[model samples]
Target: MPNAEKLRSAARLQYKRAVLWSHARRGDLVCRLMLHEHLADPYPLYEGIRAEGPVYRSRAGVQAVTAHELCGQVLRDSAFGRRNEDAGTAEPAADGPPAAADAPAGGGNASFLDGEVADHMRWRRLVAPAFRTRKIAEYRHRTEEVAHRLLDAALDRGGDFDLVTDFASPLPITVISELLGITDVDVDRFAHYGLVTGRAIDGVRSVRQATEFREAAGELDAMFTALVRRRRDEPGDDLVSDLLRPQGDERLPEQEIIGTCQLLLTAGFETTTNLVSNAVLRLLSDREQWEALVADPKLAPAVAEESLRYDPPVQYSIRVVRDTLHLGGVTLPSGTVLMLVLGAANRDPDVFPDPHRFDITRPDAGQHLAFLSGAHYCVGAPLARMEADVALSVLAERLPELRRAGRLRRRPTAALRGLLNLPVSSGR
Candidate 1:
């Protein structure tokens, strides 16, 4: 009885629903990657996406959610699980053994990100001490010293250079590698590993495109196996030693320790790397702020906080649903993946005044969720802070005539947006 027009409408409706439920396409790597950089500058895109609908299960079927309050709600809610999900999940506790079904296959790449919730929680408990406030404070002087040395050498060179390469990206890697008792291999190689890993695992990888991931994951696992054994045999006075030499039966199992080391290396190294790069890009864009920092190094700490707010390191993190959730203006179905675009949320005008403006002097600048909210917060937050403070102070003091040479280019990774190469010149 239906006419051709009605038949076409029905077909369109069916297609729409089909896109929302299919996971086969969700595993596609190349085509889905077109959305990578767009998600990097996600606010404007998110605004348009939000207008269409709060939650849109993509053609790939991985649900993407982008709103301020909604992000907070999802992240804070425990029911929005990250274990055994359609999209992906994180290892249960950093230091606990892998879950029953999610055990390391030994041969294949392990799904370290997806495991039982309790194991994830246990992992979180074991690694808590190393990232605690006091521990980070102890590392501050050293982080600053490294930053000062890098910038001072750049100033001594007295020529055009890339901010990201010369200083931002490498500094945090050096600091973290030393802290984790990882020496022998070149720091620069690990820096490359950090960048590649951050780019791959942080949803920047095409779910289908995991070849690079296989290589990186394998090398990392092999590297960690050796490191873990080394720690057990001859522990040092650093984080690895702490994890290896935990109090009493508080020790982590071998597989759990491997996963934890991988997480810590990635988290501690990459997060601060992006943080430093993001801050420098913000500074280069805002010449006045750059000049101000050059005038007073004291502004370093506050400016670093503002950078975390203005352009955070980790852009979007995902949470899996265990219960139906209502947030912002949309209700998410149980078991769906909710993508929390922190960069977009940080710019939410509801929470921050003139959220778009990169104002270091802004009083409420520190309130941003750059370090995240609640229990799953960043453990290396203080170390990141110290690293930035030292680096910024050194840049201001040493590079008096630090000025841009070319347009800043951001990295391709959606989850961590920072300069790939920020060109600048200083007076010789």
Candidate 2:
């Protein structure tokens, strides 16, 4: 059965790839987006897509929208939903890769993102308490402490350090581990799992990757299942424990709890790691921005917001039409998938003036759709923002002379834009 599933997955991927190639040959903006060269700087390609007007029909049989107003309307409309119109035909979301949207239990991270509307709300209600404004504020001090400690170690190591691996990565891993009451988890092993699963944001491109994703999912389930059992036996003052608290009829299913844990672990660190790395890369590239930040470390929050607007961590989000609807001056039938290019929308000149400029002082940068919009907005937005604000502030204060020490290696994924290795000097 597993072999059969793998074969089916392979066949689906090949068909998609072939479609992309065919449309790319005809200069279809949407299909050409999947090309490797566009990964480095896709903004120009987005501009081209936008030039075709608000709605673009690709030979691949889907419509894409890059205009800010249309993208916002599409996202805010209840007629569009996260699930594929045809459940049997799994399609990757626009902003992310092939997620386990409706995989069965013990299959993949059973995140609320994959759940149906009601199930999503139930699961979201269970986890939303941990990310509330007050709860997020409570996490700020620990975030700062973690950031400072990681920087300390990086600086103590002398010359140069890979910020992504050493600092950006570990800080979030530690924070999320503590938040989830996971005491025995291996940080590096979890990081590996995140990378393997994170690649799915770009869809499963190969059979080997699909196999690796399944393995990673199984391993995470096993770990989270063990933790769930342990917490059931002896609960503590943590998110998982709070979740396991006796709620009578409100308690979540055991598998749901495990799935939420897996999702948190997978998503909790990966996006934030990219956000920090991307922000630092941009800041250093514009020496004035970096200097301004160093001179007034209070600008860290602004820097974080602008980074999200200028170069968001998640570039696009896909929505499937649930009913026949007119959008962006085009009529799309039910079952049609619409790709919302968030990175493009954020820089839409109609909304944000001089969209490409990375100005930390951009007053309304917080208006970007980087976290998405409407129903599927990121629940971790507050936590992520808090983490980045602290990370940037601490880096500026502690390493004012920080400079690039080596090459920046970007992760090879289109949906999730982030750095794999960013070497930098501590200027000690």
Candidate 3:
């Protein structure tokens, strides 16, 4: 999604017919919106999708799930599979996941990095314990420390620098790094791999642009192989070590464990980074909201909540149907792809009154689907919220005069929404 307009214009559209032999295409059956259309804001699109009905059958077997009622059903209900998790990277081309072979030129967000649905219940089980509600509380102090350290560096330098590189990217990386006990060597290695991973799997980026991404994935696998070996011998007080520890009778494979850790680091870092940056971007543009948070620190959390609803870091997600399920007037057969418009749905008026308003005090702010729903909902949702809440509180408290330095640059990721670089003036 780095160059959205370019990617949109360049991608060759492949239309699929419902009956294969028939002219009835999925795109023709439902309201289809290009990935770019939802860029920046997608509420109007969501409203339109919602009006179409609960179950919208589009061309190419795509079922557009818009309303909170249906979205929640698809996510929470047991009828759907997470889509990509179980299927691996090789497929008959649905929502283009990172292909099995990362094209030699691939370097941007792969097709469906975050949307891979694998063992929703088991996947959740393996990771939920680490990021559970109770455990997330313990990371606050560390999150605050990391946020302060990054903010201090940015504030003290007193010069123009990208908030993402200078702030957002580092903030969450540092926290997760320390949590995973990754330092020095592992840090840089993960940083590079993280960027590659971000662009390759991010729904926003293109498939061919992720050449470096596949290379990084290979390197990451090798690195984790070494790390897991070390952790097995000498366990550390970090996540990787815990994941490697024996789990009764369900011992995790080194690769799967690596994938799990890599997934966490990639997902955990960018999202929180995006959350911090996106919230900062929204606040910087709205003078009143910025001033409100600076005045009343309690409003910081509210600001984070509202930002998730307003300009969420991660946008839409895709789900695959397991069996023929009836929704609205349509009955989608198994393998029907459902594109969940998370960002658009958050702004749906039917769900939230004055959907366009970014009111921090709005009670509906918490009701947004930014973290998603059901078993596959983001495992680190609580941790992400806590991290942002703490980071924003610290940033507002420390650099009270922070203001946008220039036109903030957005990270081209449509899925992970936020600023790639937000130049801001602070400490004066």
Candidate 4:
């Protein structure tokens, strides 16, 4: 970017940071979530917001919904949509440029998740075939194989390992890499990309962070651009090549293809990484739960669902009101930005009895909105679930005595929750 544009971005970032800090100091729960101090355990803050009622009108000028029913309603409602690309104003309390809503540093909507209805459906149709049921079944066997291989390597390295780095992180990364036909995969670099992009979800907190995020995003975009060009010349059996294939003269733009690749790579593994680590963390924390899973690895699917409810990878999502609508006893005008607290809604007492308890046997666990609901519901949900199931089951069956070997360190981002380091040992 030009020096003038860089300076403007820095100024805007600082201004947003100041505004966020001020609101957080004034006890705006929504704004407070943006603070690093709250990243460790935002669930308590979520509960506080819930105490205010299902709908919380934050002092920061954004509304948050904590009720399971209400959050699901808003997600499925046609009146609520992604922030229009042409919309001039940013979401209130946005610490930096909107990460998920607007185009990222490299420009263009990075995924169908942020596109308008027509565009979203168009992109979805083109990409949906890759994630169809038949395709997912084919991927499941490979996912299981990858999980076991990761465990084998971790176990061979001695009893001790960092689960996030040694096992949980690489399983899905490898799978996604192969799916994308990335011949020379760089696990460390891709992990770094995931960290940077995930942190961007909460928006940039500093000029330094903003710079780092842009650099990472640019690098990711460049890689995909080259991959797209290569695939066009020598098409292969991969999602990119599949997309490059024409459908009766209908073709995705080159930039959009690059964006789709970026989206798939980043979104594909990040959530599963967290889901696997989070499930293992919770299960190991409670000896009974761990024993239960170890006894019957088939319960791995249940563990995955409960973990999603107990500690979702994505804690919240934002939507813009497209028309005046009354919800949760409040009349919200058009242009109102809504923060759907998926983490909080999953634990709503009215929906999940004894909401705070994490039980693998919870019959209603699958009802959680972890993947969200309606049009914006995660398209890769099946893949994530299958990957997590295989991961947790393999770990339990192979390392039944796995135990925490060191302190847990969480990723310092509120919007996307996961572990940075999960140290563990095969307690032989």
> Which has the better lDDT: candidate 3, or candidate 4?
4
Q: Runs in model 3 with CA error above 4 Å?
A: 1-38, 84-87, 90-118, 185-192, 202-208
- lDDT on C-alpha atoms for all candidate structures: 0.65, 0.80, 0.65, 0.83
Candidate achieving the largest TM-score: 4
Clash pairs detected, candidate 2: 94-318, 95-316, 95-317, 96-201, 97-201, 97-202, 97-203, 98-203
lDDT per residue as tens, model 2, 291-405: 9999999999999999999998888777788889888668889888777888999999989999999999999899899887777678888999899989999999988898998
Point out the worst 10-residue segment of candidate 1 by lDDT.
92-101
Candidate 4 whole-model C-alpha lDDT, 0 to 1 = 0.83
lDDT of 1 by residue, 49-133 (tens): 5565546555443455555777777667677765435523231111111111122222133323344456656666766777677
**Over the stretch 84-201, how does candidate 3's per-residue lDDT look in tens digits?**
3455542123233222212111222222233334444554565678788677888888787777777667766765556778777777787877776666634445556655555544
Best to worst by TM-score, what's the order?
4, 2, 3, 1
Model 1: residues with Cα > 4 Å off, grouped in runs: 1-34, 37-40, 52-57, 83-117, 202-209
Candidate 4 Cα deviation (angstroms), residue 25: 2.1
Model 3 poorest ten-residue lDDT run: 100-109
Give the candidate number with the greatest lDDT. 4
TM-score of each: 0.82, 0.93, 0.83, 0.94
* Residue 290 C-alpha lDDT in model 4: 98
